[model samples]
Target: MSKLALDAAVFSDAAVAPDTRLVNDAIVKALRALGERWAAPLPEIRAARLSGTGTFPLPPESPRARVETIPGPRGPVPVRILMPDGAPKGVYLHIHGGGWTVGSARENEGLTSRIAANCGLAVVSVDYALAPEEPYPAGPDDCEAAALWLVNEGPARFGTQRFAIGGESGGATLAAATLRRLRDRHGLSPFAAAVLTSGCFDLRLTPSVRNWGELPLVLNTEDIARFVGNYLRLEGRADDPDVSPLLASLKGMPRALFTVGTRDPLLDDTLFMANAWLAAGNATELDVYAGGCHVFIGFPGTITDQALKRIDAFLTGF
Candidate 1:
């Protein structure tokens, strides 16, 4: 069966496994605890992150992983590059997610390295500027700069001209914006595929996000609004096409794989964006995992394994 068809069977009431149920219950409890903790001030949250409090263990950074500086709109942006054992078939530009605030490429090496190995592609993870200090155009500008550089230099750097871009949550938002910027601003259509997981496409607040309220499966409606406010730093800039790719023309965009959980507040965003992508004459795959909360792919379980394998297939297929 196809992956989507398998998902239907696995998620059906009669077919759900006990392990999956237990995993879902555990995820809910953990997310609720995290919700309470993340409700603290941004500084406190960042401090906890820096202190490694309440963070899960990740695999050690890959041996082949290395950090490099790339030219950006403001200054040099740091990128963490990971290469597979042999010559890579292509490149995957990864954007890390922290609500446009608190994530670094070095910290994401574990995930990026795994992707590099699995997809047989060199993974270049961009450490974009954060918000509330470098708000509005800073993060997007940096991401765009990285994409431009990769398009211009990746063949010589990696021995392949094929490329893909992807990210999760806020990073996914930036990835989509970067693709549009490349097409519209630079007159380039360089990426062959894209992977967006649980991204909030419409910063004006999609129906699912607006209706999510304070449930806090991972992010509450209020939390999303706050993050968007911090990034835009304006009252009504969410509607700008540059800020929200959902409002932009997606014509000439590359093939895309979109993954989201049914329980995620960004469900509507993925649904709408996938439809928009198809409407704009692109191949779009929307994978909705049952009982998954936001960013569930980072966790262990059959579902996470399935998501990762699907991602590998997508990126490696070129």
Candidate 2:
């Protein structure tokens, strides 16, 4: 990538922290290479979600980490429940990201454990159904089931009333959708807070999505279209607020923390959502990390450290 071209690339966001530039630039290369070797989309999605689970150095099994399947509306929903050694604060519901087509609760053990340990919050990471096979309501449906189960069972199982839902990328979108489901249909808002990281809240491609089309950063907008296609059927209009929570009324929504990189394709999604969140008279913190890109929090480095601090601070209010 030439200096001028690289500067124009999604990875070129000047806002990225200096310490993060080195790693982010390399990951951009890796993602581009990954995108080049396209095969069957389904297998790729499955493999993408599963690839890092085995090798990522995990903390020695925190006595807190355990796996269980909770019953969903259709059937059982598998989940990985992580407990803090001190816990007793509240429940932090987690959904993993894989563009709604891939990702599992088990794959999120590292982050879940870290959250549970650092925040002193019991973390129940939901293993919601994925897309292309499950599609549309399936992912949100399972997530809803998990949220409902947590609201009812959390006090008894985890011993707290405060509940927060969060996820990264596609998982973050489901988390938002889950909140909508809980609020609109059930007339409940037991959730105290939400932490969303680099999510595409507008499947409709209303504004920023199109402006940043096909920029090869960590995520390709073209690939985003594929993920969206697989996740929603034709009848599932892209504009449905259920699919794109940013389009929904933010009034009465829980206070939220949205983190995204200035260069992330979804950058405007977070910014727009945060502004709307405040417009709806809700508390929101929009943390735009410098020189960061989508899913930047997952990588190790000073920037990740800074982002975690922000997340921890957000949780403090809850």
Candidate 3:
């Protein structure tokens, strides 16, 4: 685990406060304390660990669109559809990041609402099944089903011009994989763009895995390994493009906005994926935040404002 290639200042603007280091340290301390507290109760521990600390509180009466549940192959899938008061500019199907094991639509309401409001797009947040329960193809299957449903049913309902997919962390990985599935199997091109924030593009362990000691914001390597192990059953299944989009051909993919924090273990994953996409001759934008940690997009008013601004600009152009 060598030092990161870029400096911390590249990720943050001068106007923003310079407390990322301290804030990240505090977050780590809290997580460590929480881990210690939950060490005895393993069953309750997964729930607590997955329920991240630091959440952006929503207003008591924040306007939100209706939540609908659509039937999937396995069972009923939940989706939160947020539309503007009137006409919408476009549609965005958002995925929540929870390491493919934990996280829900409710947990991601604030971020999705902000995206819908700021982008003037109808955002549909999908509540997919978690792994070690539903497993690998199950989560992706639900996501793809929801996305296909959006493409087939969204136009008549919302009257939007185009559709795009976006998410953070595991959600981002699902988004990328969904795009690939939609392209290869369904012959549908619903998304004109994508926004991947701190996405784990590669499921197979990378050099960054060894650098976990230096990254205070990410979960330990053991936890990450456990996640990957549970997500994929076969030995070499992780390299499959469906699980690791970085291993897939990037040709004809939509223009993308890749965002990552410097302090995250997946920082290299984001950079590698961005470069691969660019080298494959696809239009891509990379925005790296210095001293920030994994899934920093959810930490609004902190180090994520600038990255969110960049995302807003990218989606608007598309």
User: Which segments of candidate 3 are over 4 A away from where they belong?
Assistant: 1-17, 36-62, 214-216, 234-236, 300-302
TM-scores, all candidates, are 0.90, 0.89, 0.87
Off by over 4 Å in 1: 1-17, 34-44, 234-236
lDDT of 3 by residue, 50-123 (tens): 35432223223237757789878799998888876558889998998878876766677767777777888888
Question: Candidate 2 vs candidate 3: which has greater lDDT?
Answer: 2
The clash count for each model shown is 0, 7, 1
Worst 10 residues of 1 by lDDT: 1-10
RMSD of 3: 4.4
Better of 1 and 2 by TM-score: 1
- As for model 1, its CA RMSD to the true structure in angstroms is 2.8
Per-residue CA lDDT of candidate 2, range 1-318, in tens?
001112334345544566687876777676666556346566654665466432123334556778899999879998988878775588899999878876677776767788887888889898887777788888899999999999889889887898888999999988988898998999999998999999889987635566767656667677678789979954566789999998998789888888887667777787777788778888777777666767888777787888888788777667
Taken over the whole model, the C-alpha lDDT of each candidate is 0.83, 0.78, 0.77
Rank the models by lDDT, top first: 1, 2, 3
131-235, model 1: which lDDT tens digit per residue? 888887999999999999998899898999999999999999999999999988889999999999989899999998989887756677987988898898843
